[model samples]
Target: MIRYAPWKVASIILGTLVAILLVIPSLLPVSTRESLARAAPWLPARAIVLGLDLQGGAHVLLEVDTPSVVRSRVEALRDDVRRALREDQVKLTGGIGLQAKGVQLRIPDPADRAKALPKLRQLAQPLGASLTGAVSDFTVNEGDDGVVQLMLTDAGIDARVRRAVDQSIEVLRRRVDALGTTEPNIQREGNDRILVEVPGLQDAQRLKDILGTTAKLEFRLVGDSGANPGDVEQLPYYKASEGSGTLPVEKRVMVQGEDLTDAQPGFDSRTSEPVVNFRFNLRGGQQFGQVTAENVGKPFAIVLDEKIVSAPRILGPITGGSGQISGNFTVQGANDLAVLLRAGALPAKLTIVEERTVGPGLGEDSINAGKRAAYVAAILVLGYMLLTYGVFGVFADIALGVHILLIFAFMVLLGATLTLPGIAGIVFTIGVAVDANVLIYERIREEAHSGRSILQSLDTGFKRAFATIIDSNVTMFVAAAILYLFGSGPVRGFAVSLGLGILTSVVTAVTMTRMMIALWYRWKRPTVLPI
Candidate 1:
């Protein structure tokens, strides 16, 4: 058997006893709890409670509605295509993009295809020039006799998906941020789905409801300008609003918020009026400047979501790139407007597939259960190590203590919120980590029995076992990382903590433990081991 000096044996035993002592206060009063939270923050072997998956809670999966989003975008494209073709005097018959493909038209004569195909491509110019520049991508394939076909490209569909997904993600982020919840996990699932998990959320329905709706706002000019009186000769650049909800009747807007660079709810420094201040970009500023300059002293509507909110006559050129919007708004109303403006308009609708309430009561019980399991598992591991290896078990336990410290320090550094599954992952990790120590100790015993000296025995034991430990643990860590990348919510929690544990375990069990043993051997030079 391998030999350890009496001092080395005593020191290992003493250190483990002290670590156990340090953990005792967590069972005591509130004063002790606060003290423990701050003590030795780097390697807290303390048990951190987890979420429902660890203790016991329901798991929910969300499916994104992609078809709905695609249809909405196609419909909008159809409208734009029709309007542009009519404006260009292209006699187009039948459907637009949302129909068979992107666009379709029955030419009056076969020769019309020559002029129509090229012009239709131009009409679809807003789609982008890169794809349509080539006739093959834009396509005018002859149908049997003479009918030509136009179809949307795969690249165009991919482009639309990307835009829709981006818009959905931005809106979701706003809704979640406003909830004031901690560590809510939200991520894009596949090309069209969004995955979100809120810990300690008793009622998740409200969040889902808020996220699923496509709240869109649009500004459109309405009514005939002929009936309107005032500056018929001057052509008052501002049109009066003709609709409702911030959109003024008989007035036209000089500029809309889409051209804005930023919007925020704030009080006017001079007047203290609750208002939304918006600033336009360079191009938008120029457009606004031109519009206001042309319509000086003429009415203009400030519209939001197809409704006219304000109608004010243009005074002069607004070239400062910024302006204030003040209405009969409370602070909350202004804040809401700011939020809506910042989030912009949703590109496509989200249809909810699943939603459920996760009560706080359910969450608390999970925390209690996860903590209990962790404590029980830790005790079992400690007992097994001591009983199996006798004195060397104490050394393994010390290394394990170091592993726990590094793991907690890592979690705190990353600001990772620990769920119950995460705690279970840590518990499972301890089992794997302890196995490495068992392998090393058995190797050490083999070397000692072969009549090697104590120093020589340890050196050979660590060296022989190092390769196996590194290779096995590294492979497992890789698997966990892959799962975390693809898995949602608690599965992700499991992967993150498990992966972290592997790194911490390798350092403590092999390097740090060996250094301590090597240092002891140099000073003591003992002849026999306690085990």
Candidate 2:
């Protein structure tokens, strides 16, 4: 165990030096690190990322709007029902009646009801594949007097809610990423809630505004003065200066925002006002061109989140697939809208249930407390090792220092976030870093007392204690892995640090300490063991 090769010794020394260098940037002041980065861009300037608890930022808990989800699903079901009846040539006594859960319609003729029943049943698609079986999204039921009702199933609503939460998470992630914050924590909390944590961001309100806006954009024709009341609805005009009242717009959508391929913020050429320029996909472009060609000289409304943003008359067919949106917008407002359009709309509205801004002052206090705890841990551990074993203890103390350095170096390389619990994990690892060394030293002492020679005792001690060290570290590593896989937030941070510390401690305590002892023995040819 004490034997070493020339390359092995050189490699060990080189690795120690590299680890020290990797940790140096993290130890430096922020100003110094920035200056170094500017002076020499090739140097490793990346440091450990601090978690929200350590570097204080925004914490927001948002809940998906259930009612909005249900309403949208019902409206979509109504459209599907209308299309199915028109395709089957079935006559209805009244329009498809909208309900909170689903839609209903009455087929006055018994023959038409028989024909429509089969067609409407086909509209109830399977929600998703499940272990139990394929579950339909809607149930078609026959009522009295040739009336039929299509109701959304409970499982279907849950499935839709789950999908909305998943899509909203991705959309919110994209929007948050555009803000250029580092290491933002965006994840689902419960079935309906999403928790977002952005470290080092001070603009809590801006984050909320960007996240809360549904940004559902649609294009539809402005209803004619004599249009049927049922075909048009009064949507509030978004422009306050023009009028605070409503504009009558057709219920049919000409184009949807989902078809947008790109959106950017720019200034209007004629008015020099801030605006959002958007381009559509191939299908959307064709639909837009067809609509513009059919509705020339007619006004169309640009609607956003159920409100009319603008109503402009179509001059001619626009086949270029690109258009601009002009509203009473400042530069920032235009940019925000462009961001939302590019990110895509949320599946449903999200209401903020909880919001908090963590100031940097509390983070500073936490960092200071962590630092003090770490310092005290190192001092106590080093002092204990020194007093326990004479010269051999010094080697163990040096290895412990190297272990700490390796932990931080690994974290920096992996871009791990450090939290308060992570600091506690580090301190705890300091106390255990010398466990292997202690075992070896104690075994060596027993061998020496049994009248064994110094070299024989050292070799026998390490070889005998090696298996125990590995066994203990392996169990701890498994525990850390489990904690990391199942835990969230601060628990995850602690797991990361603890896991890294375990691996590093094994390397330093076993290999490096043995190497130091071997070199010391060769140089001094000690007649008696230190312990």
Clashes of each: 26, 0
lDDT of the structure predicted as candidate 1: 0.65
Mind giving the per-residue lDDT tens digits that candidate 2 earns over 194-284? 9999999989999999999999999999997588998999998866465587888999999999999999999999989999999999999
User: Could you tell me the TM-score of candidate 2?
Assistant: 0.94
lDDT, candidates in the order shown: 0.65, 0.91
TM for every model, in the order presented, reads 0.73, 0.94
Model number with the top TM-score: 2
Tens-digit per-residue lDDT, 412-482, candidate 1: 55756677778888889889878899888888889899999887788888999999999999899999999
Question: Which candidate has the top score in lDDT?
Answer: 2
| Clashes, model 2 | 0
